[model samples]
Target: MNAIEKLQSERQRVVARLAEIDRILGQYEELQRIAESYLASGASHTADSGTVTDSVKTQAEAQREPSVTEPNLPRVKSPKTPMVEFERVVIELLSEAEVPLDRSALYKALLDREIVIGSPDESSDLNTLSARMSRMKDKVVNVSGHGYWPKDRAFLPGGYVPTGVDDMPSQDATSESGLV
Candidate 1:
């Protein structure tokens, strides 16, 4: 095809794609409205039934026009706890913990304090937290499978010492012996 014709064709395709996107956005908005109405209509009633009614299902299906289906599209969710706040809460939890806190315990603590505002999936949330902790090497220390400890050793519970730490000589001993 000639350059002019090809350019026109591309333009037409872009316009068509934009229109499709607009339609999909509208459908999502309608779905959100329906969900909001359902919530406002006392979702407890639905929960008591323990099964979705056919009418509600059909109504939703009818509202959605058949189109290109991309089942893996990412969902836009509520904002997560800010990085600074997350780090602060984690430090607080670790410092208060008597011993190293395992991932499950830390996750539970975070949830209890409402600091974990990330994914609803437990594994994903754990992974995210693990990654964050890994990056906080200067602020926290991981005791292998035992869990996390505050980098500030003083924050550790009284008489609690991480494994392998006892094997190392103290700075005082090394300095006194002129090992520095």
Candidate 2:
């Protein structure tokens, strides 16, 4: 009924429980060994029948039916095309932005998409993307430092003032005299 007696009683119970668990674990280990031995013997028998496990299709079954499978040929990888990968990405980015984007903005967009530029000449690099975009005059129109946009008028983004239009004098100018 005192603290010392209570502590001793609890310790004894814990020791007994641990001993029971150890006994159970030993039996499990022995069962696992027996299962492995039985499977090993059974596998030799299956090997004698000449097939391994996708539910063990036997040699007899293989011959009694036509094997529809052709022999496993080496896989041939298709050749890569000559198109620059980043060029496509740049087009897509500009299309999504709907505005003409410069190199830095396009670079930032690429970074936002987790694409880091590699080197000066790599397709994903800033210089390479700029060069590639410059060459695509039919596809993209430059807007100075702002960015690039699709060349078609319908695809041109809102708020864009086309060159020379804002600067040109209105064609409606007439002489002040009211002569017909």
Candidate 3:
């Protein structure tokens, strides 16, 4: 072959090698992109798992610890004595009465005993006495429909009296009579 033809053949071979190199570089770029995407996806998945584990651990810890407050917890008031002096006076008045005294009667009894002598404030209304009676009904004494009664009437000095005439005698009376 002549020199020009040989030179032409060598140039064609060089051009083909350059095209192969370009194709290999393109493939390498594609592989590098896929690897980067996979790494990012793996990192995101790990982060999500870590967050879920941390949340579950926090919830478990909260449930395991004791609470500071509980519902319907009974609270004892401070300076806890059996009964106040005013409450005792009221009980004394009820123990002496033959019939069930209403709230007004109880108030009058209090005034007679000089326990609640006079109004303390300018409002000076009967509502204050009514409120006190309500508090006594709920807290200090046991009250029936009509009036207030002492809780431990059996222990009182005068003893208990039946409110109604038709009411039967107590178990003590029946046992004493040998009805059983």
Q: Which candidate wins on TM-score? A: 1
lDDT of every model, 2 decimals? 0.60, 0.50, 0.46
Residue lDDT tens for model 3, 14-123: 55444444444544543453345456444332233433123223334434444323222222111111125556676677767654567777766765654432355424
Estimate the overall C-alpha local distance difference test score of candidate 3: 0.46
Model 2 TM-score is: 0.34
By TM-score, rank the candidates, best first.
Answer: 1, 2, 3
In angstroms, the error of model 1 at 40 is 31
As a whole number from 0 to 100, the lDDT of residue 145 in candidate 2 is 52
After superposition, the stretches of candidate 1 with alpha carbons farther than 4 Å from their true spots are 1-77, 154-180
State TM-scores per candidate.
0.44, 0.34, 0.32
Order by lDDT, highest first: 1, 2, 3
User: Using lDDT as the measure, which candidate wins?
Assistant: 1
lDDT value, residue 54 of candidate 1 = 20
TM-score of structure candidate 1: 0.44
Between candidates 1 and 2, which one is better according to lDDT?
1
Worst 10 residues of 2 by lDDT: 73-82
Candidate 2 residue lDDT tens string, 10-37: 6665554544445445445434544454
Q: Whole-model lDDT for model 1 versus the true structure?
A: 0.60
